[model samples]
Target: LENTEFNLLSMMYDVANILAFKAEEKGLELSCFIDPYIDPFVIGDPLRIRQVLINLTNNSLKFTEKGEVSIRGTLKEDLGNRFSLWFSVRDTGIGIPEEKLDKIFESFSQADTSTTRRFGGTGLRLSISRTLVEMMGGSLSVSSVEGKWSEFKFFIYLEKQASDSVSRKDIDIDLSTKNILIVDDNKTNRDILRQQLLKWKCKVVEAESGKAALAKMREAVDSMSPFNLAIVDLQMPAMDGLDFGRLVKSDDDLKSTILVLLSSVTNKGEIDTSKNIGSSRYLSKPLKQSDLYNCLMAMFYRESKSEKILETVSEPTGIIDGVKILLTEDNLINQKVAVKILEKSHHKVACANNGEEAVKMLEADHYDLVLMDCQMPVMDGYEATKLIRSKPEISAIPIIALTASALKGDREKCIEAGMDDYLTKPLKREELNMMLSKWANKKHKQ
Candidate 1:
């Protein structure tokens, strides 16, 4: 879960651009364009906003075949203090019938049987998008021509920034002045890094392959504008990122350049393998802002940023075992109640409002165990746990899920997501204590 405030256009466009590679696989062109006049800075739940954009763009990609799928943003109203932002995803694939436009937005509905058979979706995207938009005080709308094209749009508002107050990452240095080169064969991964770095005002250049990246490096040296940093994906063809990193480090001409490795953790054990490569730092894939931010800080200065658990053993009984644990849940009432209960038992406890916060806390501090909520926003417990499992360093720390219900198959899903156990809601004091006792004493393996 990431909490950094970002420019509105950059945030939305990042989500839109990440799917470009997926569209490319289907032989379609995908792009995102933002209006220049928009204030661009806004503070909101970026993850939720991204979810809405990705869903819309993905839907457009599914039906698009011959032409392009594009995301466009423009200013709708200049309110002085704030502005209304409008975004649309237009596709030149199979268009929806005029009469069926409204029908498709209905719950569990698609355009028609033929549409479902060909495109393959539950038709729940618009329905879900409408709900999410309304929650953010926005409205979702659509327009299309039968068998020609489709355009889905939405409007949201953001307060204008009087000045630059987004984030400085607590460093006085201006990262905006730095030049960076991004290397990754996967278009989506490269775009993700570009969006993040560019938002910080850094100059960015892209290299689709490792060899191209090396060429760009040598060219920059010749031009007397060598990159300050190069973030390369750990997995690439013709030259693996490890070998590429070695080559860059060995080159006397590129002596001062910083190299950070990006790993996908496709092979769980490779997380350790990545560390063996010489570089400033290495991070797991689907790159995280906090991790990337700290990695940059380390290159300038080092420090920071976790996952699942195994079945833990119970400790000897006492008046209070004095076990320390981190509890991540979004419900304030539950937070208070859980803290009250744990404190009385002489257990040290801390809380995170959401999964994203939970991950950040785990990275910066130590906790004997984690009580994770399954459905919280930013990053769900399921995803958080999977990420933890990918990191060999923290994967063995036990995690128990806090789920609202124990519906059929819910346990399996939690376990698959890497949780060692789960606690049902309306949680009983006895159940909470028992689960903690099972996991609380065994510490994280160093």
Candidate 2:
């Protein structure tokens, strides 16, 4: 097995990110949590681990019509240099029958023939996953109730790489002095947030609901200690994040407290609503530590009054609004999805069916950035980049490569082809936002 030292948290984020668009398209919530206490840098076969997770999560999404699919990793046992990690993919989907469960992991076998016809799979994923997990020193297991939910889990021992461990000092923003409030109806969500905040040395207080959070905030205020930040969940029962944010913003005393609203991927449109309600930032779940760190960095660090971090974090389009982007791809479906994601962030997007069209479009108009797909019918992204670089006028614009290939060295190939960066399909909106924020030239935005 390809054993290497990798950031466990980053690997989990990549899995969630790659599947995020799919989960959103299916109208499902995808949540990922890795135990905060565990040192995230570990020695293991990350690729195989990621593959198993993706397979299980994809199956969960395929079968689940409603509710959420959660991927969680807990520190089962701390064994000094090695740790026993319990990983699980849980979904509120149709589960296997008790008798059929034993055969589900058999090659070419499924819960039933109807399941094969309905879900449309070769039914080899679980079998292959079991093989991979066992190769990695773990045995895959499942628990399910036929009509309700299913959970696939395994325990694997990984060597903790303390030399590569992430600490509070690694974060760019200073959170030690910050007092934060986490509001979520789910205790697990709150606990995860609390643990993360505590790890960053932030003082955290949790509330079960928006109303309870308000009470806690009031108590903190009355005691001459007020929370500077509040993280609220969007889908709470009675009072949601938008309503809570509105109430806080309108209050004379609590108006200064920064509000960051967490929403499911499907509720991304509600970002606009959160902004309208005066929330400082909106993050789509499942949240990654890097994304949360970036959000906090934006909140805490601002250059000027005009460039308020709140607006930078909350605006409909992106950090730089009204950017003009040219999308180059041959596939109609990929082109459409990319366009929609770009436009949703308030950027103006133009599509080129092939690389030749992309070159022609660039010649005709100015664009802030170019999203170039590697393979196309008429021409390819590599040739298009070379041609663009040969020109003096439009040569400086950033060209981010989009590829479906996951083979090793693909990124290096893209960079060698003169691409600024690369992303694998399908794309996630949060990732696109981060990329745009990185490559979008300020002068190019309207």
Off by over 4 Å in 1: 1-78, 86-102, 112-125, 131-137, 142-152, 160-173, 186-192, 195-201, 265-268, 288-290, 302-446
lDDT of 1 by residue, 1-446 (tens): 22234555446544543564455456555656565335455555454466567667877877888767777678889887777888788888788888888887787787888878877864455676677677668999889987889999998776655564523112223477788999988664566578667766788999998899999999999999999999987767799888887788789988578888775433336555555655677765444454565567667544332110101111222333677778898999998888888888888999998877877787777676789989888888988876665443444456789999877667656754556678998778898887776455323110
- Per-residue C-alpha lDDT of model 2 across residues 33-129, encoded as one tens digit per residue: 8876676767777656776787688778888988788999998888888988999999988888999888878877878788879876535567767
TM-score, candidate 2, is 0.64
Measured by lDDT, the strongest candidate is: 2
For each candidate in turn, the TM-score is 0.51, 0.64
Model 2 segments more than 4 A misplaced: 162-177, 266-273, 297-446
lDDT of 2 at 245: 91
Backbone clash count for every predicted candidate, in the order shown: 5, 1
Instruction: Give each model's whole-structure lDDT.
Output: 0.69, 0.78
